[model samples]
Target: MIGGILVLAAMLLTGTLTFWQQVERALADNAYTFANSYLDMAVTLAGVLMVLRGLVYVLRMQRELRNFKDDTWSCLELLIHGLRDDVRSIRRHLPIMLGGLLLLGLLSRLQLILGGVGFNDGWAELILVGIGVLMVYAFFRYRLQVHVRPRLEALEAVRRELAGDSLKPDDL
Candidate 1:
């Protein structure tokens, strides 16, 4: 999925560059306006794709959660596993998201500097700052999880003891 997204983004970028070149060659009266419109469409499409991807991920997670057995200990274990997976997923994607945002910001700034209608500096800065905030938020959540997991495991241990079951190590 990530590969497909990257490929599509690259294709859109290549097409945009090609179109800009053609517009430059033709020197049409509304070339910049048309180019800007096309760029906007491409960016909008990318945004929509990202939102859809996130929605799908959330739905899938919900479905998986629904499948677990309806026992407290099992549910707790599932939650611990889910948190670990969530952290891993975030860690894997954070860099890619950051890089993509930075690239987008750079492209927008370049377009502005080159006298083309493009995303304003404020918008780009806002996006970068938003990503930074999200990064920080994810980091804190991960720290909380790190601190919380052991306590959860201990609770699981106590539960097992009360149930006269031997404590077992988690496979996570």
Candidate 2:
């Protein structure tokens, strides 16, 4: 494997061989094939950030209305308005996300080749990237445990109160 890499590296640097240039071009050709998908991922992420923003906005508006002694209707309207806007935002990004994901599936085969897995061509790269994504998710969820678990646990008390289940903050 090391020997094969050394040979390929030499060929890429030399440029005396047309084959190496062709391979490089092939690898780089669909650079934007996944651009939209990546953008879609960003847009989806912004939706989560917006939830926090909306919560702040709602709380501020609710507090301001309390001064006027007629806050219920205003708060409800603000919540509904924010929700509608968020739903529209998410809906708008759906097609972009789907298109981008489809492109990722087509273009992500580069992963296996770059990762030095010995897969030069074909659908194996796509499958490998899929497996890679799953492995990454599992690592984050189980091994690293770095994502959503903490937030969920922290909110457990609120969730139980909302459901009228209990007032215990034990999980937190």
Candidate 3:
């Protein structure tokens, strides 16, 4: 709110950009840089998270082996417990992740609405801009999920296997 106002004030004071010029530049920036950077960051971060998830599983498995080399049940129990913790962590953090998506949607909509300033003077136009933003967000959400799905499936598989056959994996 205040931050947005301050940014606009800075732009005006600098005399380097009129509102329309800034809008055009912002459109180009968003089209070329912001979305691409956001997507790249998302993919990279998801990969990092998956790697960390795998590490947690491996570390716990190793610790279980070290502690209960002779106790098969304890090893399985530890493995299952550790995997459950990871699943729980994901469940707990899911809302925050979705909130980030929602916030991004709102910010993008605000940008679009601001850009459309001279073109349409009605609040109805603002609502239309918001709808467009949601459409864009939906596309982003689908694409991101497509990329992240396999990693999630792999994690879920390990969790399910541990839960279903905890006693057997301990032998190997």
**What lDDT score belongs to each candidate, Candidate 1 first?**
0.57, 0.47, 0.51
Candidate 1 displacement at residue 170 in angstroms: 21
| Residue 69, model 3: Cα distance from true site in angstroms | 1.5
In Å, residue 131's CA in model 2 sits off its true spot by 9.2
- TM-score of model number 3: 0.38
What are the per-residue Cα lDDT tens digits for candidate 3 across 67-161?
Answer: 66656555555655664565555545544654564455445445545666343334354355456546755664564456445545655566567
Expressed as tens digits, the lDDT of each residue in 33-78 for candidate 1 is: 4333433533544455455555555655675578565776666666
For model 2, how does the per-residue alpha-carbon lDDT over 68-155 read when each residue is reduced to its tens digit?
5645445445444544444444445433544454466665455545655545544654555456545644553452234334443444
TM-score of 2: 0.28
Which residue pairs of candidate 1 clash? none
Candidate 3's C-alpha runs over 4 A off are 1-36, 70-77, 117-172
Candidate 2 CA-lDDT value: 0.47
| Candidate closer to the true structure by TM-score (higher is better), 1 or 2 | 1
Clashing pairs in 2: 37-100
Q: Candidate 1 or 2, higher lDDT?
A: 1
Measured by TM-score, the strongest candidate is: 1
